[model samples]
Target chain A: MTLALPAAEAARELVEPVLREAVARLDPLTARVARYHFGWADSDDRPCAGGGKALRPTLAVLSGRAAGADVERCLPAAAAVELVHAFSLLHDDVMDDDPVRRHRPAAWTVFGRSHALLCGNALLTLAGELLLEQETPGCAAAARALNEAALSLMAGQALDLEFQGRDDVTREECLRMSRCKTASLLACACSIGVTAAGGPASLAGSLAAFGAEAGLAFQLADDLLGIWGSTEATGKPVLADLRTRKKSLPVVAALTGPTAAGRRLAELLARPEPLAESDLHDAARLVEEAGGRAWAEAETGRRLDAATRHLDEADLPADVRAEFLHLARFIATRDH
Target chain B: MTLALPAAEAARELVEPVLREAVARLDPLTARVARYHFGWADSDDRPCAGGGKALRPTLAVLSGRAAGADVERCLPAAAAVELVHAFSLLHDDVMDDDPVRRHRPAAWTVFGRSHALLCGNALLTLAGELLLEQETPGCAAAARALNEAALSLMAGQALDLEFQGRDDVTREECLRMSRCKTASLLACACSIGVTAAGGPASLAGSLAAFGAEAGLAFQLADDLLGIWGSTEATGKPVLADLRTRKKSLPVVAALTGPTAAGRRLAELLARPEPLAESDLHDAARLVEEAGGRAWAEAETGRRLDAATRHLDEADLPADVRAEFLHLARFIATRDH
Candidate 1:
């Protein structure tokens, strides 16, 4: 997933060192947990470059720059957002019983489950402490954003948990849960970025809309890949969500409608045992046949359209606007 | 435990309502977590008093009064400490896997462990948010204290988990863990009370020292009960720590001595099998025969002495001094 320049390149220069130092600051045990989970360190705490994609921090820094601020000044804020995102992923992996993350064993798999929990909690406190270091409007906005985002993260998590195994879940419910589960935190991340930069008044509103829509698009893309992408590309078994009984947007949309494939899905859901290896292909066929694939693609395109509209409304310098537009388009269309 | 208040209580008429209101202002879910943990709400979120001894909050209020501040002024600080304590208890229950809390099923046992985790995290945030409502000198001190205590708590927790299976762990290691796990937070709580009171310049040192010793006393008493208390009194099975191979102070001291009883205990440790219920009696007998219990009692007394010395050094008013002294005596000597 190569991103468009100016925004992405400038963000890379600002975000990498800040993230590196933050991970370095973790005491030995914390560092080990982070390094292993982020693929940066091995089980023995030795450092490696097995780091993450850092998409969230990139968005933060790029948004800061696009708002006409020196993106470097917002490194702490960007690091904080990334830390929070990583922490959420750590916990989400546990909550979702996801064994593979980025093609490696999840943090809870490497460290003991409770150890992962403590690491997540520590990261959260560290995030708060980091925010306390920021000056004026930044500190104030960060505190608000961190707490609000945490609350929304919990709500999103709860909604996801609530959706598990429920075959009759509605598309609107899936979309709403997606907004809370995925979009709110992303939107808050962008808002905090702009807030740290003392962003232009006109840009905040549009940037926020763009972030929310971007988040929705991202989730839609992810759900689509869960069913349709090849394991080589996504590093996940196709129809993984269906196997886990995850009520993703596509699956719920299919379950809500009554087509020949939908009836087969209903019959499949009636089974009490785990899906066999052979069941995945059949499940994918039924899901696609019931319009799950098309519905998800349409939703993805719709959300991407709205996100672009918000980027246009952002009133950035022409070059910055072009950069944001390119980046948004890349995120919406990325394969992995 | 019973407390001997000053002959004439301080006029603390105004603070209670504000504290109540601050707590009431919490989100409904947060209030539910707090109220349920406090025994003021049932598992279903119906209203009921949680009924555990609100010992920490009482200490905060009385300490505020003794320092010449109106109790009304210190209620938020008092409530904040209780919230922190509640959060600790919520997490501790999960870590320990203790099935019961306050004569009822632990939060994890009732609400499920994940929800318990979320509840604990929420209360920690509430602790910070509640403190922010009143910007007394206590605010920064309390924030710093809570942050430090939380960090120390995690350290102690890490050490405790690390020491879980080993019987040869040193007494010094146990003491260090105890200080981090129990003493620091207690001292922080007491110091925050004094800070909340806007007390005389000379009083802070004594309050801190007093708090630290009192905390050690609290842990000592706790260790004693782990070995000797009845199941009904402790709300835990008899010799629970012994069965778990906890490297508590008594067990640590005995293992080091290698006395006859210690040797026998060490032999049992090598077995690495489930301890029979009958073994608890023998474990306690061996621990006593190794003189571990006697040493623990002496250490408890030493800490009580330190606390009393600090209390006397403060040169508090006769009535205030009497109340604190009585409380300390009760703490160091309590049977349950």
Candidate 2:
């Protein structure tokens, strides 16, 4: 993956130091939890190699570059976006009761839940602090963008939680939730990076549209992996979403379809008891037979095409365009 | 309380509308939870009278007034402070597993922990949004102050959680935690109010000092109530602190004291089983016999005096001085 997009490594290098400095501002315990959650260290605070792909930060850096800004000027915006992302992940893991993240135990699993909650609060506060620390012309605008995205992300998560109790979640509702939960912050990262670099608002708009589509497609790929990807590749249990009956894109598509397999999948999901391994396997098969997997695949390609179209509209230099296309493609097709 | 300090009512009137408007921006489910948490609605979404004293928002309004800013100009700052307070209470109740707040069931108890958590996230985000929406010169400074207070508050909360497992908590460490958890936000409320109104930094500084002292005094009063106040008055279970083995100011003071009663109190708190009702009663008596109650009372008075001294140094109008002093005294001496 690093070989496929060397820019990811560069973005990590540019943003990780800033993230470390910001997280260090936290109280000792919270900072320790944050460091471990970011995969910079193990639960015992030993150094480790378990970090995410830094995809959002890469998008932020790329957006700044497309706007002809130096990487230094983009540092705060990039780090702020990643901090918000981390904050959401920490809270989401707790809310969802998931035990894994970035191929490692979730922060809440290692630390206590309350400590993880405080760490999430600290990270969100740090994100605002980072934007405010920058004395650039675009600092306030960047802060506004980040706040808007955070609010939208929370709203999306709320809807996702609401879906857990109901068996009638529609495909449109699922997409809206995904847009709020996943796409808003990605769009904010792109727009805020350009804004932080004092880029033109028009360029930021195009990049934002590009990011929204790419983010949705990225979520579709994630949903696919949740149901069928190898545990080794995804670093999560196989068919985890099926076992939990998560209302992900593919699951919603399958449940809402008019096929007999779709009806059977819905009935399986509505059961009171936890799904067994066999039941989960059967449910996954039903979802595929009902065309959920194929629909999600098609939707991913369509969204990717739309994202590339927006990038084309930006009239970027060839290298910048190539980098964005490669990144968008990766987001739409990654196993993890 | 309202008759004794009309400013409290005035502040509520000024800030509640702004808070409502901000909360209305959240997703429907979150907005409902927030409305209930704010005491603007019940669990069933009906109107309710249950609410806190709005002390933090009142402090903000009074600080703005002392700086010659109109009540209108102070709305954002006042509401932002209250929102942060609400955010903290929601998260704290969840973390502490408290069953009640403001003479009503805690939001987490009524609506589930995840919903309450998301509502806290929403409120915190709304606070930042309120500050940013203000286009005044002092808006950035106000946001910075709020973020700093929030960070300090989380640090304080982290330490408090850390203290739960350790039997060796020092008085100094406990005081530091109280300053971070309680006083920092109060000071921020004062300073941010002035900053939002474009007041002099010197005035903000004096008001912040006053608020910090008063806030500590307020915590002492709360700790006293946690042990002795009637459930009807305090809106919490009597002897709640002892039952939970909470390391509140009084308990810490008692545990660190040199008396035999203090040593006995430590032994009781260290036992693994849940403290029975009789054990809680015994622990309360031990804390008092160890002079914890007396010390907390004297310290509250001293802090109140220090608060008034800072207010005197500010050279406010006679009416403003009287208002601040009345509020400070009320805070130090309140039974609930």
Candidate 3:
């Protein structure tokens, strides 16, 4: 999850401390649980090295800079977005019952579901606290945008859960879920910085559009990796999404494709037992043969182009536009 | 439960519509789940008549009026506190794995755990959104106070979960958890109206103190009911908390009481098997004989007195103070 672009790496470095400070404001027990969930600490409360990719925070800071605001002034918005992201991840793991996250046991696995759930709640509240800390002119708008994104994120999660175990899920439904679950937060992340800086709403809208497209591209790439990426690189099992019978972009595409291969893939997926390694491989192959993989790859490229177009239309400073373009490309092409 | 106080009934009528409006602002699916959880809708997604007691919102509106703010201006703050209360109940039911709420199947029981959990998240985010809706001078402060209260509430829930299945939980620990889990939100509900109206901080503090005391008294009464109240009255199984071996205030008091009956009660509670109907009766008898009921009753009276004192210290208008006093008394003595 290394940042390929120097600007992304710089934004990550700039935002990490702010995130740490914001999380530190939680009560001691919640702070400890949150630190563990963020990979900043271990079960024994000892320090750890690993953390998230910081993509949302980086987008926030870069978009702030692109909107003609100082990067330092965007730190709270950056940290706030990251908190919301972390909150979603914590709850998502509980909802998905995922045993692992970030190359380690998931927070729910380590701290129990109750603790993880409450930690998520605390983080969500803390995000609001962070957004209002400075009393800036843009704080109200920023808070509103963040809350709207949060609500959309939860609605997306609910839809995702509803889509599970249903064989009739449409590709359109999957795409909508992806947009709501992933793109909404990313779009907010892109816009929150500008809003926090009191920049023009028009610029914020363009950056949000850019971020939304980039987010879709990122999710499409992720869906591909979930089936095809190496375990070493992705830090997850091979065909992880298929193993859970997740109705992700590729699976939905395969399930609903107009081909005999799609029917066979659905038949294979309908088996009641846990998917064996051989079954996973066969499912992945069937999905690729059904044109799901190709469709996703093409969609990723389309979204990336749309994202670049939005960035260009934003009319940001040349260097900032170039940096955002680099990050968008990096997201579309990243292996993990 | 019926509101015995005219002020409580009036506040409910005022705040219920506001809460419905705030919830309506959520995306359709999330809003459906929220309305269902609040008992405003049935399992078929049609409208229903029953709902919560609206204690938090009532407190908020009354506290605002006591602070000299128009009740209309306090609607958003009132609705926001109710949302927070509903959010806690949704999550708490999941964590407690309780099957009943407001005399019906719990939201998690009816809508499933995932929907309930995500709905709770959406409601919480909606609370912040509602708080920020009016852009009042005290919006930032109101949002801050709400978030802080939410954090404490989660921390208290975390502690409550930790205390489960433990035999060594002290009375002091139980009381602290009660305050965190219940009193914090009540206090926030008391203060948010004043903050939202830009009233004096001192009045807010006094009202919050009053609410906190009343909250503890309410919880104490609830603990007593959990052991002694009939199923018909409490809308729960008889001795429900005892059946779950909850470390509630009365149970903790009985467990730590310096009486021979306390030791006898501890021995009875230590049985590994689930308590039978006869055992529940014995447990209730033992608790009363150990003076747990007497102690809780005395404590509730003390808290009610302290709450009235705080109300007196708040220097509110005479009629408003009388209304608040009536509400507090109703909470402390309610049968359901």
Candidate 4:
């Protein structure tokens, strides 16, 4: 946890300038949208201070460092990952109809949905252009990784939206969606960092394995926070997922569980009207009673352990391994 | 026009299979959405016969042929351009809220806006991946061209949307938007086709100039049809752009003209209520009286002439030059 803030800050310091440069390559209108979305500008186009946590870029740069590359050499790959993350968030916020992001109105709410969508696409294109401009063989491999992860991310989002309309979403289906939605990009970030650093495919594979496990753990923690974390800590309303009847891991686990509480949870969720505060509380209790909370907490520990094993097995210096572990642990246990 | 239909058919036969194969890579839910968007599948998930004109792909393949390469070497580039075109159309439909495309309900209308947007993104990623998988150095240049064109296209769309709210859009601004939104992709298509065929940058440059001029001519023709063509030809209600108050080239020219007809046209367009059928006819007449239609017609002819001159100067076989001219003329004069 201690290394987490410093690692993110360092990554942001190196990558944000490159990201800004890439966004500036867009047309003035699109550039304004990109700046506002990235928290470099407010809705009125003034400078702001609400950028992202830079977690993905941190992983990219650290993974490169662990593979014996200089930080400057990793800047393009790191910035690419951060741009992809921002692109997905922009589109996902519009699709999910969520009105807030990072303690402010979402980009779609500020700029309108069409502009947000177009700007997201512009960022994505810029991400690829950044890698291509590097003109290195390793950059080509990194670009391929980014493309594969982007495809998986879109497919995962499609599934997530599809699940919203159905009550029969299975645990396996939810797991698959989560793997694509969260783990694939994280895995790509780790692997592409090393790939861009001229690491062998085998080494990238090991790092990717570590990242995927850590990513799942992060998702579990995120879902738990959706139900129980403080609004200040999570930048969302308390029990926000339940109020929106989101089919997160715990909710799906409880919905498909073999218990009376599970059936009641489903019934509560199936009602056509929006859930009242009392109903949201009742649903949270039912999810716990059906053993969903216990299962998720235990599974999170298992994933974290698997992730640590990956780092332990990778041929990295002790300090590099510690940094990876600190980052994984920090994301999985942030304020919870 | 005789060569036009045959060339398009040839390109479709070569490129559609590859395009279909690339789309098949998406996860099932997303793949379904993609299939629907491409007109390979109906809304009920059954196979359908409705697809695009394959104009961009034809241009890509023909440009390669004109650059002294075999058609097989150009398939990937052709498919990549087609995918980019489809991606833009998907997003553009959502942004413009146009309910139809190519004689059918638009993808956003049938699959919902969110799925349409995601599927569009999926196609875009697929386009880049298609280039990378070729493993040829020429494909790298093609990828760069595609990325640049995609960015310009987005910028143009943003401007187009911004113009929807304003009454002071200049003729220069409209021309710039048309260049970015329409000409850029077509230029990329021609340049990438030549680049992918191992042609020099100079050759690609000439073909891109030809394609850009042809593309502007195509846009001018399309805008005219938007105002005057039959539904059977343009696949929308008559005067569709007028109904939506689209600031197309001729409309902008008329609105900014120094004639009384121009002033009357502006007042008519600025009214809050929807225009009646008679009003649409009157507006169309005003555009003509104000010299907008005459100006656009003359410009289209000039662009087509320039495009043909570029083809004549390029070191292409006689038949290849003829084919390119035929395609350009066909698009510029379709059903007009």
The numbered model that scores best in TM-score is: 4
Better of 3 and 4 by DockQ: 4
Name the regions of candidate 4 deviating beyond 4 angstroms: A1-4, B1-4
- Tell me the TM-score that candidate 3 gets on chain A alone: 0.98
Query: Worst 10-residue stretch by lDDT in candidate 2 chain A?
Result: A1-10
List the RMSD of every prediction in angstroms: 3.8, 1.7, 1.6, 1.6
Give the poorly placed runs of model 3, Cα more than 4 Å off. none
TM-score of each model, in listed order:
0.88, 0.97, 0.97, 0.98
Give per-residue CA lDDT, model 3, range B258-286, as digits (tens): 98888888988899888899888888888
Evaluation by lDDT, superior candidate among 2 and 3: 2
Q: A14-72 in candidate 2: lDDT tens per residue? A: 89999999988889999999999999999999988867778888888888888888888
Q: Proportion of native contacts found in each model? A: 0.13, 0.82, 0.79, 0.80
Error of 2 at A284 (Å): 2.2
lDDT by residue (tens digit), candidate 1, A236-269: 7776777886788788778778798988987886
Q: Which 10 consecutive residues of model 2 chain B have the lowest summed lDDT?
A: B1-10
Clashing pairs in 2: none
User: Comparing candidate 1 with candidate 2, which one achieves the higher TM-score?
Assistant: 2
Chain B, model 4, TM-score against the native? 0.97
